[model samples]
Target: MRRPQLLHLGGRPRQHAEREPRHRRFCRSSVALTVGLLLTGCAGGVEPGDAASPGPAALPEGVAVEIVQLRADVAVRQAQVHIVNGSDADLEIGDVAVDDPRFVAPATRVLPGRTSRVPAGGEVDIRVQLPDVACARDDVEPSEPTVALGFTVDGAAGTARVTADDPLGFLAPLHERECRAAALAEAATLAFTGFMPAPTGEPARLELTVTPTGGGSATLVAVQATNLLDFGPATVDGAFPLDVTVAPDDIAPIVVDIPILPSRCDPHAVQEDKRGTIFDVRLTLAGDPGEIELFVGDALRGDILTWVSSWCGFAGTP
Candidate 1:
């Protein structure tokens, strides 16, 4: 396993955010009815000799397609598929999907309010909700990930299953992130149990609960920083070191009171929050190092957000 590390998003652009899970919508196109069912409500390939069928055009042999998994915001489960049209002709695309051995099921791209069209020399990026990680072994990299690209050529609709490229190699890290989280889950469940609002400029103690799953003994390494929150051993200097251990025989949960403070003073900081309430925690079990993200419940998150605004004296004062 890779060394346990925190996931920092302070430097990441705020434009990258996954607001919510996109719903499946239909695309109006005439296609082979038999293949339409497999596309998750999208139209399928059209028959060869249909009079209404436009002659389908084939994508270039080497189309630039890759998965963009931006590990920012709450859209950690969402990914984007970028397909660059290398062909000279403009193709009207339908459903786009990516298949990888590391994932249990293929993820279809989601274009909330945009059309799936690939103009010549241009690219189209559609969001996709990643399926459950298939962690059968330690090495979870998919050897040859593929994409099922549905497109219209000369008005003819067809689906092409081609080898998808990972130029930036986003899959390996994704695999690591999910599989590591899974491993940590099997060992224990970590959460921000509770928090009470403190006066402005005063330190607040947030409770972190670690409930072991009796699978193995694990050690909490550290709690990583978030955009609007800071944590530490006693104060918000970011020096919190949780070397606490939870063995399998330990029946009761281990509770730790974490000192936290609002790291930002700008009103937009809370207004444009994405992962402000999430806490990235690193851990170690036996010799394997792993990292997991813990989140507070909705009520607690709201409470914390309100506290931040009050502490920072934002639009909504406390």
Candidate 2:
């Protein structure tokens, strides 16, 4: 009963000439009047070719980066660098790293043997391994996400300090989920105590016992649905948050029943299952709402998988 939790630019431009090409330049600008006029942006706010390399630019208002986790990435300790390029030009991305206060260390992008890029007015997702949580830090400010981005804008190389935009707002939730899970863990322990199969495609009740470690209080909100398993009569989307109070100072463990149903009929789902049997528990620890994902353990996982085969009439398909 435990839980856990982008840009590219185009071609190289001429340099060190009396007339520099019209483009964004981080380096010295050309002295020629035509070149200077053509150069759209230069570093240091000085004349072209007169100043130091351009400092990282502020990401345009429409351009944005955010941290997101797809279903596959949820338990893999990975996420995507979601980039939305609403600007007028394409961005050729180079080195990318995320600066998130909630994480103990910064996260870097994982390239798959090719240059990562975002087209103008388009979107891209770059995979990155997630970092450890820095949630225990009481001294730091709340989650403020930013990216140290190396990119090419208008054929000119530049770096940017971009404020991440979260349309789905996954960052703060990630922080809250981890911190609350940690707090609840310190206060109590949650584990799948038992499973009673009803057989013949009926709802099987899974038991979870909450043992108070005698520290804090929490409410077991509900269990969310997984791709292959569902809690019925599950949500319109399936598996909803169950309501229960796991108060502190309890001498004995409290057992709660989770009614589960098989949501998928495909045998391949179980054959290649990753998180199908795993469960996410929504809870409020000491009034701070968050979610904790618990694994069914190897033994129980096999049992659940087998039970699924039969329930879905998939008994030997695996």
Candidate 3:
């Protein structure tokens, strides 16, 4: 497994001494100054689409196109597309390109010639490679990873771009599963309460309950909680069964203590201060789709806001 140490927002590596190192101080100062100036330009937003250089024109009549699976890894991105012929006459489809310099559109060879006899369900796969200049980055990964694909149909043209928001976050689809959510909640509850709060930890405890929106069987995959801002050690319970089933309208509550410095801050602040760290859950359901609602003590608001499926990890069941 490859693990890259992430730098804090301050642009300095963590685990270093509180005092800045003399040699790296100059570099850090310069980066911070540059970021501050960039913030000023962001106050005024720019208008969309320029009259001098407009996007590709609309697609020709009788031709309809849809783009899907705009997927990418650390290296490349691919898209699966489906085109439909709505008119009586055959439509010719050609190459796609993004006109902007910030976007790269590799030459493509797939062409659906003018023919109406072919079924309306024909599909195509197109790949777009990022240019070195557009993909260049120093420390943190670039947020906008994908580019727009401009399509031409029967001589009419238009463009559409896909960015990071179009794809699920690294952990989004995982949290969607109920079984994973239960497992993750169970692990976080255990870790927060494992230490004795009197000496150095907090005095309060934690409890987690998950009520499935649908009646179905589910399984737990993995659970993870990062102590991003906190310096305390996190712990887990003994190995337990992975299958956690929930009947219709049933609620399951798993209690754990969250160590808090009551002397330092109020209860609301402690809860609000996840400290940039996140508690994760991975769950799966058998029959139908559902949501898992979370509660910390009497207040009920935090939730595992997404869904999950069986084919998530290395080992998956069809």
Residue-wise C-alpha lDDT for candidate 3, range 1-318, written one tens digit per residue: 001112122111222133235224333333343343233222312125534545344332333333333212221222322233333433333344322222233323233221212122222233332222322223433332322334444344444332212222322232233334443343332222222313323332233333344444454433333322222243343111224544544455443334322222233333333322234433454543343322221111122100001111122211
Worst 10 residues of 3 by lDDT: 304-313
* Model 1 Cα lDDT, one tens digit per residue, 137-212: 5465457576776667656576666555454466776677777777776777787888977899886778988888
Question: Per-residue lDDT for 48-138 in model 2, tens only?
Answer: 4524765335444456555556555666566766555556787777766778888888877655333456667555567676787777787
Worst 10 residues of 2 by lDDT: 1-10
TM-score of each: 0.72, 0.59, 0.27
> Highest TM-score, which number?
1
TM-score quality measure for candidate 2: 0.59
Better of 1 and 3 by TM-score: 1
Candidate 3 ranges with C-alpha deviation above 4 Å? 1-199, 202-204, 220-222, 229-234, 237-245, 249-276, 287-318
Instruction: Report lDDT per candidate.
Output: 0.62, 0.64, 0.30
Q: How many clashes show up per model?
A: 2, 16, 18
Q: State the number of backbone clashes in model 3.
A: 18
